[model samples]
Every structure is written in structure tokens, then in C-alpha cells.
Target: MSASKIAIGCMHLLAKLPLPLLRGLGKVVGRVLFVVAGQRRRIALRNFELCFPDVPEVQRKAWAKESFEVFCQTFLDRSWLWFGSEELVRSRVKLVGATHELKGDTPTIVFAPHFYSMDAGGLALPLNTEREFTSIFATNPDPDLDRWFMNGRQRFGNVKMLNRADGVKPIIQCLRKGGLLYLLPDMDYGKNDSVFVPFFAVQDTATIPSLSRFARLGKAKVVALYNRMTPEGYVAELTPAWENFPTDDHVADTARMNRELQAAIMTMVPQYYWVHKRFKTRPDGEPSLYSGK
Candidate 1:
């Protein structure tokens, strides 16, 4: 075989090694990423401070370390989760409080944040009797690479995927047909596309306005769900929408709901907070998050 081909084959073999050794090596790589490379640490550090302004720097660092641990567990066990049999996955994950409020024949919209093992919910699909997931996906390149992702996730019983650009129409159609569509409401989209919501009293951004607009226009049931890691594995909880939930002022309502969700996120998942560049698109005149307070 060619030299490059042999090198690539060797890497593949290493990736398939025993879980313990693979996990150990993964830690080494993560250290390289966090300490040496500092890829997302800047934002992680910034966010930790923003969220815990009163806490000491030492305690903030503790939370940051815990976030790394959670991420490590999720990343190392990735292959096992994707390829493991249905029984194995079902046994690991359990859903609680998936009440009737979560179900109904309407365009149901569920806002699921990126918990440490949030995607593990995909494995718990067939195991669920209450609802089937039809995902709204942000498309990426590489069909062959993404095939395994689809195989693990797209169970095809009632589950579906939508390319991000064309996601709106399908989601609206699903609502009209009385189906469920999931969206990640926490991530920033762009200027005017999202608004600065008071998350932890800081101007954190979110995309739930799209959800609010969808709900307002389609009158879909807006549900909040989270997949949190438990000692056994993970559990999905359906937090019913507030009584007389916002229907009039969508932008304002979206911001209010995101604040409520952020509180839930802090309580359930202190770590694996899906630390992202939340303040990158700050409004004009706002202090840059990168600068030290």
C-alpha cells in the first residue's frame, strides 16, 4: 500500500482499540486541546465567568474541568453508542415525565439544548412510546462520513432529518401535518435572526424566536425537553409549557422562555454546558466578552 494509505489504515486501527486505552489516549488529546491548543477554552473561560460572576476563579475552573470530564465520557464512548444493539442502548437510557403534554396531534416543537449526551436521545427513540423524533438537521459535507450518523439517528419509524437551509418549510409542514420537530434553541444564528436574552442576567443569545414564530403562526405546542446524564446513563424529561404561554409578543416571549430554559440548564447540567462563542455577535456598544472584566 502507499505510505499515506498505510498511515490512514493505522489510525483507523487505533480508533478501534479497547475502550479503556482509547479513553486514556483521548484524555491526552483533550489535554492537548484544552491546555496546549486552547481551542474553545477562551470562550469556555469567558462563559464560566459570565454565568458565575460571584463565584471565585478557583471554583469556576472546577466547573470548567468538570465540563471536560463530561465531554470526554461522551466522545470516548461514541462508537459504542452508535453501533451498539437496540437492547444495549435502550437499557442504558430511560425517559421520565414524557407526559401527554409532550404528545398531541399538532405541529409540536421541542427545544432540546446540546447537553453532554443530548444526542443519546436518538438512541432512545424506538424505546419511546410517547413520541417519535423528526429532526431538523444542520447539514454538513461528506456523505460517507455522515452515513454512520444517519444510521445511528434516523431510525425511520417516524424519525426524520431536515437540511438547515430548507428546515423551515419542512418544520412548518410537519406542524401542519401534526408531527414533532426538534430544534436547538440556545445557539446563536446571526444579527436580527436572534436577540439578546437575559440568561443569568447576561445578554446571552438564542434561536427560540424561530420556535416562537412557528408556534404563533402554526399554533404548535411548544415543549421544553432536556436529555441529562444520570448515574445509570441518561434520562429525557418533558417540562410542560407555562400556563397561558406566550402567544402575542414573539420576540419578547422567546427571550423570556430562553431565560427559563437557561435556569433549567444550570440546575440539571452544570457541566457540558455546550460552551460556545455565545457573545461573538454582540450588539454594538456592548463590552467584548474577550476582554477581562
Candidate 2:
């Protein structure tokens, strides 16, 4: 069998295990990653250095370690999310806020940050609610993995996953039709449709202007969604929609998004995805953040 197939088969078996057992295994996997995943560990540490400089080194190290464990648990949980029964998955998820009561009339954009279990929250929405959710899915390099992701994300059959390269036309149209868009706006997608914004007090952070633009064009209401790992299970919370969003100033709106993201990250310091090179694309003539070994 191909590597992807073997992975899928393993995950299928893993999915049958109890949540606590899977999480215990994930903790072991995380400890190994903390020592061996050198580059990613460095990046996570760098992120903490930049974002939480006030935090003590020992505390930051502990946070980074926990972050790895949470990330691994979320990673492993995908199998249960993708291949498990609807009742099994739904039982493991607890809805914390007004996501249960949201009406599908107004165009809704659920702004998801880079939490490890963000996909769990996305999966829950379409499975529980009757609304159709649409989101942009970036194609994976591995063909098999890409197919798996596409199939898993749309398993509930109420979602429309568009390729990221397909541009924003489809997303805007979907939102205009009053569908839910699970928009993840925290990545550094370069300078084309993005602008440098202050993320966690870092001025060189690259942020896309699409979130604000989509809200205006589709007449969408923006709400924050957080999926967190608790002792019982994953808790997915949806804040009420923001007021006076997507004003005439796009940059200000993007800044507002980042500010909210910072606040949200504060609530659950670990579990936010920190392995990415967020500050890689520096401004004109600026030195790189991850330069030294």
C-alpha cells in the first residue's frame, strides 16, 4: 500500500480508541516532537519570544511543550473527525455559545484562528447545523493526502470546499447566497492581496484584506470561533457577530482582526498553531526573524 493509504488505515483504527487514550498517545508523540522536530520547535519558540516577550523563559518553554501536545492530539483527532460515525463525533464536541442559535439568513463568516483543533469546530458546524458551509481549501502537495482532506472536510455533505488558487469569486458568491464561510485569516499568504499589519505588536506581519472585503461585498456578519481541547472533550465556542465591522478603512479592519486574534490567543495561550514561519516575509530591506540556527 502507498504511504497515504497506510496512514489512513492506521488512523481508521486509531479513531476507534477512546478520546483519552488517543490524547495520551498524542502526549507521548508530542514529547518526542519537542526534542526531534528541531526547526518547528525553534519556530514555536521564536513565536513565543516575539508574541509574549514578557513571559519567563521557563514558562514559555512549558507553554511551547504543551502546544506541541495539543497540536498532536488535534492532528490525531482528525481521523475520528473524518471517518467516525456522526453520532460519535458529535458526542465528543460540545457547543459553548450562540453557534447553536445562529440563523442562516444573514451571510455569516466564522473567523477561525490557527488553533490546532480549528478544523473540529469547522466540522461541527456543518454536521450539527443545517446550514451549508463553504471555505477555501489549499491543495496539499501529496495527491493522496489532498484527496483525503477534500473528502474528509466535505464528509457531512453540507460544505463546499473551493481551491485556494481559484480566487475569491466563488467564496464571495457563496457568502452572497447566505452560506457560512469558515475563513482562516491568520496565515502569511504573501503580498499580493495582503498588507503588513501589526500582529501581536509585530509590525511586519502580513495579513490578507479579503476578510474585510468579503464582509462588505457579501454583506456578511463576522463572528469568532474557537475550538479548544478540554478534559471532557473539544469545546467549540462562537462569539456573537461583531458590530461596525468592515468599515471604509480596510487596513484598520485587518488590524482589528489581528487584535481580536491576540486577545483570543491570550485566553488559551497554547494550542494556537505556532509552527508556521509567520514573520518570514519581512518588509523591504528588513532582516529575517528566523535567520540563525
Per-residue lDDT of 39 in model 2:
91
lDDT of model 1, residue 248: 84
Off by over 4 Å in 2: none
Error at 36, model 1, angstroms: 2.9
**CA lDDT, every prediction?**
0.66, 0.86
What CA RMSD would candidate 1 show? 3.8
- With candidate 2 superimposed using the best TM-score fit, by how many Å does residue 25's alpha carbon deviate from the native? 0.2
Across 1-293, the per-residue lDDT of candidate 1 in tens digits comes to 55544543444565455556756665566556667536567677788787679989987777776666567666655555665556656766776675566555766777677777767765554456446567777654655446556765664346777777784776777667777767676766667677667766476554547767777666777777777766566787777766555568777887767776777777754445546766666777776776642
Residue 123 in model 2: lDDT: 82
Judged by whole-model lDDT over C-alpha atoms, candidate 2 comes out at 0.86
Cand. 1 Cα-lDDT? 0.66
